[model samples]
Target: MAAPKEIPLDEIQWHDPFEIQRIGGLHSNTVLFYFASSPFFDGTSNNAIVYNQAVHNENMNHLIHTREAFEGRLREMTGLEFMVAQEPAESGPGMGTGVWVIHKQTRRKREPKDEIIVHAAYYLVGDHIYMAPSFSDIVNHTMITITEKLSKCFAIADKARTWSPSTGHGYNTASATTSAKAHALESKGTTPMPNTQESSTSEAKKPTRSAVDSRLAEHSFMIHMQYGGEYMDENPITGKPGEFHLSSTGRKDKMPTLALPSLNTTMVSSSLTQPDKKDAKAGEKTPKTPTGMSKIKRKKSKAGATPTSA
Candidate 1:
């Protein structure tokens, strides 16, 4: 389509004269109007469009003022020419009925073709005018919504996590207590309480086999240290009994004793008969046998000599 002429804002004149031709008791307003499927169409059978003339006039004045203000803003900034064009209805429902405010800048080109750039858009659905969302606005809104949902999911997962080292995971004391109580009530025979049973079992298992063996070894060592020398007298190599008795007998047999010499009866009688030796001279003495001689010499003398005359 050919682009609209770019007119300077100062050269344009403002007018408010509105005229409409009535046909068959029906009239249509064309100031700031666009062609679209609306309930307020000119030749429609629905006559509620002009039910209140005062309200219709007020809506037209408001649209006129809004367009004037928007154009004044563009003129103040870059003095560029702008126009509001009707947007075509899309294929889907509720996709049409909006106006686009397009900015027109003359581009120097070899051919006479102008490009129209849309600065902003407004939707006049009923009486309300809504500004269409920009691309950045839509992206920011979607990101914020997703972040909120993700945060809620993380919070739920954190609450569900209950694993720990000491108590393990999902340990419930109340459930255990309830089961114990139920078991106690259901039994017909005499049985111990849960606490008593636990205590008895723990006490019964206090001394393990290894601990008992260690204690027994310590007691035997103490007894050996106290009475080992007196009672433990068995020979280690021969396994004989009487080690202490044989040791005592050997000690007694190895003891030393004093000895005396033996004398015959004849000698004793001679000595008794010659008792008055005071008159005998010291040198004139009979030959006497040495009494210090060993028993072997005395025995030989006895055997060699014949019986002496009495």
Candidate 2:
């Protein structure tokens, strides 16, 4: 590629469509061709069609013409010397073709050490020219996106929150209420009332206890009725004041008594006279016999003096 020719600010002529086309030649892919063909393009003024065509094309002559027209328009309208410079591509793909439109602080001779302040930058890649976004624009867009996402999150959290006077804050109240209702319905469907016949049958099937005296009274009444002694005044054997007794014929049919073993009198006396081991351990003392005549001697003396005593 040929080196870019620097056009002096004083030498740049006023933008003229016919002159630019006559010098640079027109092509289908050129911004100038589109501008010439567009009905809205006036010979002296920049219009939307011409500007958009410049942005969409990548021709080198188109870039020069666009810069010239911009500078002329700014000089005519704002009286500012806004210069445009084509910079060499940097070290990466699609970085080769870039144009930096700059605004200078002073109109003196251009110095190599002077700081160049960029007003805007345009990048050419493949068949199009794109304006680079400023830092402020990127920051503003990121802040807006974060704000929108936070708002959505807050809305969802608010909807999930549940509040009650008794339970305080919780989540998913609707599901809890649904589960309670389901449990109530299930209990209602499963439980039934007890029937009268069923209750009566159950009571009849259960066993009950009776007093011993009441059972004996019932048996005595049955015995009296079977022996034809229902109106008897007293029991003949025990002399008890009762009408329940067996007749003579029923007494003959009674069962024999069971034999009981007899207890030994000597064994009973020996057991009663013996001192218990528990009483001996408790420190109990046995009473001693009085110092006097024996009972036998006393009885003999009483017998011998029976008549002498007056």
Best by lDDT: 2
User: Residue-wise lDDT of candidate 1 within 67-174, one digit each (tens)?
Assistant: 454333333332223244453455367886443332223222233444434444444433323445667777988999999999998887665445443344453366
User: How many residue pairs of model 1 clash at the backbone?
Assistant: 0
Across residues 259-290, which tens digit of lDDT does each residue of candidate 2 receive?
98664676456557868676675556653433
Assess the local accuracy of residue 100 in candidate 1 as a C-alpha lDDT between 0 and 100. Answer: 34
Root-mean-square deviation of every model:
26.3, 29.5
In model 2, state the lDDT of residue 270. 58
Q: Which pairs clash inside model 1?
A: none
Off by over 4 Å in 2: 1-112, 172-310
The residue ranges of model 1 lying beyond 4 angstroms of the native Cα positions read 1-82, 87-110, 166-310
Residue range with the least summed lDDT across 10 consecutive positions in model 2: 100-109
Q: What value of lDDT does candidate 1 attain over all alpha carbons?
A: 0.46
